[model samples]
Target: MQLQQWAEQAASQQDWSTALQLIELAAWQEPDNPQILCRWGDWLAAAGQPEEAIAAYQAVLEFQPGCPQSIAAWAAVLNEQGQFAEAIALLDQASEQTADLWHQRAVALQSLGDWPQALTSCDSALQLDPTAAESQFLRSKLRLGLGDWSQGSPEYESRLLVFSELRDRLPSFGCPLWQGEDLTNKTLLIWGEQGYGDQIQFVRYLSVLHDRWPETPLLLLVSEPLVDLFRQLAIANLQVATQFTFETESAYDFHLPLLSLPERLGATADVIPLAQGYLPRSLQSEIRLQANPRQLQVGFVWQAGETSDRRYQWRQASKSVPLEQFLQLRLQVNHCQFWSLQVGPARQSLLQNWDWADCDLADRMHSFADTAAVLNQMDLLITVDTAIAHLAGALEIPTWLLLPKFADWRWSLTGSETPWYQSMRLYRQAIAGDWRSVFEQLQQDLNSRPY
Candidate 1:
């Protein structure tokens, strides 16, 4: 078997020792082979040996100079290690060596928050390959960040081709593109995309469409995670459907992605629906005991997901704050009740710092519904860009959404508010993974609030 295939199998089976051995053998057999070297670097990086990966990639330049893959991979490692300047330099070199290299360079620059430079790259990328899905997707992201929705909206459609598997599963073997025209009296099927927060952000467009075309039949094709929450809307002629039962007939006249609504509605910050207190319901007495009213009821969520079984999985999980950060904030804010809205058990130990006086709601709530019941009484939700923020936004409750600097396009970079949720406020890190500023801002914002 080829070393690459063997290594892939080893990694798949979590036989990292075998994978490492195979990569080393491959590297020795072809020391000057850039592809082999780059693969070794990938394995090293995936194994949490980024420093070694950087060396492996750097060695590739000795034989095959200006190799884009090597340059891009090395730059990525550098970026991960916070060496943004070095990473940008490498990406720039790679871009100049090839046509449309600016796209990769632009992404590197975007990671560094150089939007103007990123824009220049996007222009170059579009010039070289206007039809390229990635270039268009990145352009859309940069445009959204630049507050240029007119251009970004169309670019967002690039995802349909970029993630072809998702497109393949759709009724049509293409993105459910819409012109954002009238849908009154017509049954419009809208499906969610990407993450839960995405669904929440996009659903705001539903309310907008419904109001504009009150006569339209809105059939929302939602995920199992959100059916119960969306069912609460139950607007006349509005139906929530999950699980594609083939027996169910195709019933909609038009369709669009949940994320596409912003483009359709021409949403900007000034026109956002910013209402307050979305999910208004009292919890049972037993549930109520889990929250303390004297302390400002603050809900916390850290960590995103743990799907990958590799060294990098640890880093993906690190997107959340260590438990001490939450504990410190709970104490610093003073007179605040702390509760966890986190979904998984892997990081529950982080709450050990909080006194028993603070309730740990992580285990008590079974799903979003149980969590929503607790959130209904919350004074505030301080969470990363996860589903709970979406839930809070959907209910029109006051929520502070902490976003990574490159944030989802739906948030739009120019504002403290999102058009999707009137009561939702945004706290963005100045740089990706830099949460200190966001936390500081959250503390200040909470202090200024009436609640």
Candidate 2:
């Protein structure tokens, strides 16, 4: 096979290292080939070498100015780096227009909070290619932001296509995906998807599903860490398990992803399953509270799980506050006992100046169940956008969710309240990346409340 052919084969199989090697060999043989350079650039971008990829794309532009492929790929890398304006400019300069180019432009515009324009660009792309999953998913978020849940929830199903990693993990049950079908005597397998926060947020749909089919047996498959916590639902016909066994397959007649339950059940912001609390009281060991008159117990989680992906890394940074800020807040409040509900390497932040009154449950709290138990003892919970926030909300604990300027779509824009969790209150940064104002507001609110 020719060097270029071999490289294409390797790329098809997702062997980035081998693909890069073959592309390098092909480039060496045909030193001035713009196509080879573009191939090299694409592979480099896929491997997360943005700088090297840009260099290769620039080389292609030098040989063949305004090359559509190089321009689009280069713009994509810039978008990944949060240079939305520059990416938009580059896409506009492209000589050719394609569905992908418009989609990339829409993504950049969306990042800049240009929702109307982003929606327009996304529609243009979707009109050209209706099967473009990423564009469809982006449109769904835009629609949701506008509170058009009727259309948004249905379009959101494209997530299975846009996030290939998530789609690949979905098990094939050899049965049709369960819509709102008759299940008087049937069994349904409800499997988990996305992050812990998403699972917690959507699990409320199960109660509705149970009510609709009171006689139907519902088998829930969740991550191991959540299995114990979800069991608290205690639905009479529902069984919770970490994984699905082949022996149990015959028991279920149909299956559905947990997140998909919303669309299937026609859940809207106004008509979401409103409940005081969904999770049952956790029976796990709880941290002992000190006997002090006029003392308030508070729990806080500052950081999310560590990630190397640039997208998630940015999210983690945006949601997290420096430990110094939390300490300052603790100092400002009187007779308040702060508890560390943060886990992973982020928990080390608490060791800087250990206070005896502040209970540290980092070592003891293992799963969502353990965290829920600790939250049960607290008067209030303060956290960033993480699973703990969702858990507290699910448990009907008073929770203050600190949000960045460009918050997640679920929280919506311009709101102190959320429809998902009635007990949860949102505190957003007036300016992007500014946590001081949020903290100040939180401090003021705490000061006004009776201990």
Q: What TM-score goes with each of the models?
A: 0.80, 0.92
The digit string of per-residue lDDT tens for model 1 on 161-273 reads 76655667566623345677667556777877876666765665677777788888777887776776666663666777675542356566667777777777777644555
* Candidate 2 structure quality by residue, lDDT tens digits, 189-252: 8899888998998999998888888889889888989988987885787888887742355567
| lDDT of each candidate versus the true structure | 0.69, 0.84
**Candidate 1 worst ten-residue window by lDDT:** 309-318
lDDT of model 1 at position 235: 62
Model 1 score (lDDT):
0.69
Q: How close is candidate 2 to the true structure, as a TM-score?
A: 0.92
State the local distance difference test value for candidate 2: 0.84
**Cα-based RMSD of the predictions, in order?**
4.4, 2.5
Query: Which candidate comes out best when scored by lDDT?
Result: 2
Q: Which stretches of candidate 1 lie over 4 Å from their true place?
A: 1-30, 39-52, 80-82, 92-95, 171-186, 245-250, 264-270, 273-287, 290-293, 305-319, 351-358, 403-420, 428-451
Q: What residue pairs are clashing in model 2?
A: none
